[model samples]
Target: MEDSKKIIIVGAGLCGSLLALRLVQRGFKVELFEKRPDMRRKELDAGRSINLALSSRGLWALDRVGLKDRVLETCIPMKGRLVHPIDGDAFLSPYSGRADDHINSVSRPGLNALLLDVAELNDDIQIRFECSVQKVNLEQARVEGFDHKNNCSFSSQGAIVIGTDGAGSVVRRTLMARTPELLFNYSQDFLRHGYKELSILPDSNGGFKIAKNALHIWPRGHFMIIALPNLDASFTLTMFHPYESEIGFNNLKTKEQLKAFFEKYYADLLPYIPHYQEEYFSNPVGNLGTIKCYPWQAYGKCLIMGDASHAIVPFYGQGMNASFEDVREFDELMDVHGDDWDKLFTSFQDKRHKNTNAIADLAIDNFYEMRDRVDDIDFKEKRKLEMHLEQNYKEYYSKYSMVTFRPELPYEKAMILGRKQDEILLNMVRDKSQVVNVDRVLTKIKELHENMRNEI
Candidate 1:
């Protein structure tokens, strides 16, 4: 096929690669650039997110590129969250009441490599590695960057330039440079807490030491550790804790302090991770933050998507899924606008800005919920009622389900409706005198949703 228009996509990560593949499929020549070496040819660095939860939103995007089934083949189904309380035995909490609803645990690099492979299959898509984007000419749709391997600078122009370069995107920086003209709005809020990746090695018999088909969480009052299974029967554990408290990352510097802390808090998990001390000291503590910005498009010639525009905390496990959804949404916009870059870019940003912002806020809300409230009695009661509602009524959807499973619902709508439902459910569960009637709860929720719909 002959290509008349070209798209310059910055960053060949999950979002960029998927976008490149879809654009090439749509008959536009795609030039995809990545700063790092080709991951397919090199081992990825440790300490980054090695695995991710692949849910409905992400799978919808994969399906658009004909890679859904292949990707699913590489994932392990995580049916629910296994919550381990400090004072009680571990228990499972299903993600959804519907039997078929569950998330998948897939390696981050594995999925990226698969998308890169699919992107490379298209003759119209050109992927360059070790090429760092230095600047973007917003008006001209031109990108200037240094080619590390070639030891020189390079420049390219496209009909439209899309930035998927992640949170520290140079494309986004270019927009910030012209902030006054674009009326750009930007804010980055970091959490006092940070995370470090640890691992639970596969057992001697090559079997999982913990529940294989669940996301395991050990939630403390102010800190927590969560693990997701890998296809190799291993689990990648992340410690989400503060950096300055008495039991924080700053104070647990010595091997003795680490061991003693684990013995006191994560005693059960301590036996599973034998080299906890070594791993703790070797790994880097990554900061958590949410990045939000406006005017994702500049002069309708350049646009930013994924983490480049809205980077959120990883508490809700929706970061990658949200990025993938960006691609799917952008593709939908293209279906209407075709190669009219100006209209397409403008509409895409306008439609997506609020949705991304909604998810960003929801993710932050989930940070506290995951680390502090997951094991609380009131929270547990609310969840139990939510599960019952979901099981009994086909129309009932929890906030988690709406965000995770309902791809048709926008994040903004989900957040608005789900928050109302949460308040009502929590109130009913809190009242000991009220006999929680399923029918009554369902009717009230439906009425609340209708009122919200009318107000909107």
Candidate 2:
């Protein structure tokens, strides 16, 4: 392939920076445009979800760029979710088989900066900050943007324009406007629930108040609190609650109401958050929404990826993972088609649209499972058996293992395969049939496992 093709990438966020690096590596000239200032120089806004859980799908992409070790340097590995029971002792359950079945906890801005730095290192990729994408002109294959300081509009023509822009993507909006009948469906469902971040500052001894190597969840049915570790030995705690509850922060105007609410509902978290009073009042509430769209590409000259294509709730922590996978897939398709823009993009959209929608749906469904059902007696028993199946069957069976630890299987196929296996196990439990032996189940799972491995 020639090294002269020029590409304009909008939004130098995680997905955008990664795609730029990959494209540059393939001998394409790339320019990255970002609306925000140099994130490396600025701190993330206080109330935003400052960090996220990075799993296999995301790590695999970094590995492709030869940056896995460098990225891991800033991460704290969490072995599993530490479930805090309302009336009993907290229990930590591993997501994968071995003690090392873990996910990395790292700051969003930190990861983004690392990716941007790597992108900049490549002479082929030129990054422009404070450049807001205003529109995409598909006819001319160019991107129009506004300079923040000069208030002047600028334009760049490219072989192709990729919108790694976020949910409110100008590129996507422009693409849809140009092709209204492209089988695109767009919707955003705002959850009645909202989230706010509170910090568990490091103790005097410079250690975490709770386990640093675990994701702590204070699941209280209608509302829950989760804390993820930071490299600074502090924990970023998020409170997810209904927008309007009897004793929520919604209607509480006085400190008395605030104290009463915290003492009653979030008592488990109060001790760890010593400055809760101040944080509770100051932190801005973040609205939760699920964004869905179809046919993520328009003409050969333009396409959409990441949250711009399918933004889901953060419960499954798969948003970043899915977006990273998109970058990898797009890069591979471009590689296979030898820069035949139309052929490569058509193939990418056909394969990626279904995969993105499936994961987006799963992310939405996971919210209820985390908030309302993780602690249910029957659900817990089933999950325990599911974990056992992952170990016993080893080759054919897995629950959390496939979702978090493996990126080889497509998200939709993994979901379908898991449900079928769970249904078989659930039937056995319902009938209390010991004759429905574990060995028999393992035998059945082995065949399915073989199929799954091959399909991926």
Candidate 3:
């Protein structure tokens, strides 16, 4: 008889839970371990945080597991970015060419709850909340961790232990010790920016003070504040600024200093935020981290996915989306390998490492573009060239359309193509002599697309 195959997944966050669901659906016995108490047992305070932008990449993964429609029930779609310029009214900026194309904001804990519920229905999956891995025996394919009672330590042997754990992952550390060479090429940059959340309470008439279908951005040169809609007709606003900014909450400790900073920087939106002073001063600061790693899976017996593999900066609004994509890519590899555990895992790592790295860089680059360059005239001109490329080479070339709208292309390939396109467009824009010739650029864009297609 074939041996009973088992997989241990650490960290029951979004990606971990989804991985459990997918594995169980394929008839594999799966054990999910989480360090946190069951989230449902306690109130997840809004003071901590709320939603994430559920983009196409994220939605596709959920849909594969039959969870998308349910997730959509709680999501509020952000049709376009509402940029709050320094002097003018906020204007809508479309990312995918069409105004209707959008990413949705859904509560993080809410989505977690849904995934957990579905996972519970899988008899093949055993979820152990409040259980932490104390040690991992990579040679033996086993995990030693504390149980829920926190008294006796227990050891469990599985075919492989996959670390879906977050950035500071114990499993990852264990993997590092056992197989130092497999240690991914990793780097992290903590942007000077930090974030604090504030709420816009629903109006007395139960109406939203801001547009419910928009991701609002107040872009100042060194900082930005973005607000995404919630189901309760309220918006969750996040204030992001350089750690060294004189107006940061740390420096503006007094109410007078805080108020003066807000008045000068975010005057129009301040009144909409209830208890702005209290929330701003009292809320904990959220840090932005960009992480890149390689070789996500070890053979077919062990693997890492999601944040454990790539923790990206949130500026691109893609941390969760990329994690979800990791799940889908693994699943696809499983299909290609015909459920051969070893082959499936080997293929997964080979296929997904570059994709994850590409998104990490994309996320970092977007930080600069969003906060400092989005409104620059030169940048806008380049964006215009991108539009021309998309229109003229609809079949061969696309920038936002492919990255944001198409899920067929791997993340790494999309980034590669995007960089190539960016280089071409930058050159076109740098030539002031050709600035007035739109038709000439269109011809160049088509030729570039043909050359790119042939090379691919």
Candidate 4:
């Protein structure tokens, strides 16, 4: 018999779209709704991050939907971070020792459009665009929303509601309202810094203005500008700056002030973006914050996923990847508990929240690492040692590699082991008297991993 229990998903972005496709594959009818008009049809406002780093975890989820190879065709391989210091020559920091292990720079809309197209192919999925969800009936699995196109309000109910809405999720708001009864715990912590998107347009011949294969970062002490390559040959540049300081986004009110600030701090980057001032003034400043909450599922009738549940700062380039991982993990849970919504929802929220929390904390840790410590002598030495360890030992995976490249490893396990490995490696690099011994370091790491595994 066809599964009569319909899965209603709100927010037809990356997670929602993918989840809808997956649910259809599992023989469930899916009602996918989006607040915005379909990107495949209309040109929406350029959202927060134009491009995202798609790593192994995200690729794994795409593969589940048989869209991985197709998605890969649209992505530019970012082999590693190309660090450009203000005063020194630029350097390449390889993400991993393994040549095949690298992240891809994929346009957000391009990928989302592709996913939506694939989701639409399935007859079991019905997608509604421009359907802004106003309120959700948590216990009843019903959503009431305003339909912008029809200029009317509509209501729909499902066997269960799965919310894949982004950070500012209306579905999540509904859960918050019923917090006292559900014992829901939520916290949103914003970074002191915010980001503004700028661009380095393609060269005269429509060629890349900078290295097209690596993520470029011009890290300043208190702020940074990072650029990711687009298939169109232009680089999407983001300026992550404080909101209040003299050189901050808040303080750079006038064109002249922004020009002077760029000329002083980002002089090297100014050439690539001749229209920096215009782009800076034109783009909107986006806030960077982490959202954490408990009891992702309410009564096994409603659940929240993606940024809607665990939004994190973008420093680690894992927000989208983590959301994608959620789909993959949830799908795995479905395999075990087929249409048992109660067990599936309970087990998934209980198991996945810790892993999401680990990545949230790690993303914040990377904010400091990317902006303040990427150029530090100690950090450089530590990375060098990590690279060497990864190259020599087949068993060794750096913290970055474990998180970015190892899709099989849970984020919580990766965070724990990777942090321990990082401390050991950093301490090893700090000892000037000791010769850099690869075998000894590997032994120590192996022992540490073994101990951690046993303890856990």
Tell me the tens digit of each residue's lDDT in model 2 across 265-384.
777878887788788788888888887776677767888899888888888888999999988887778669978888888898788878777777777777887777777775676666
- Candidate 2: lDDT over CA atoms? 0.80
Each candidate's number of clashing pairs is 0, 0, 1, 0
TM-score of 1: 0.97
- Per-residue accuracy of model 1 over 1-456 as CA lDDT, tens digit each: 123368899999888999999988888899888999999897877534479999999999999999999999999999999999988899998999899999999999999999999888879988989999998999988888999999999998888889999988999999999988999999999999999999999999999999999999999888999999998888999999999898999999888888888988898898899988888898889999999999899877899999999999998889999999999999999889977788988898899999999999999999889888888988998888889889988888999999999999999989988999999998888888978787788899888877777643
> Which pairs clash inside model 4?
none
Error of 4 at 50 (Å): 1.5
**Cα misplacement distance, residue 173 of candidate 2 (Å):** 1.2
TM-score of 3: 0.92
Per-candidate Cα lDDT values, in order, are 0.90, 0.80, 0.79, 0.90
Give candidate 4's error at residue 383 in angstroms. Answer: 0.8
What TM-score would each prediction reach against the true structure? Answer: 0.97, 0.93, 0.92, 0.97
- Which residue runs does candidate 4 get wrong by more than 4 Å? 1-4, 46-49, 433-435
Model 1, position 94, has a per-residue lDDT of 95
Better of 2 and 3 by lDDT: 2
Candidate 4 residue-wise lDDT, 1-456, digit = tens: 124378889999989988988888888899988988989888876543489999999999999999999999999999889999999999999898887888999989989988888877888888889999988999889989999999999989889999999999988988999989989899999998999998888899999988999999999999999999999899889889999989988889998898889899999998888888777888889999999998898888999999999999998899999999999999999999987888998999988899999999999999999989898998998898888888888888987898999989889988988899998988887888888687888899989877887643
Q: Which stretches of model 2 miss by more than 4 angstroms?
A: 1-4, 47-49, 247-249, 429-456
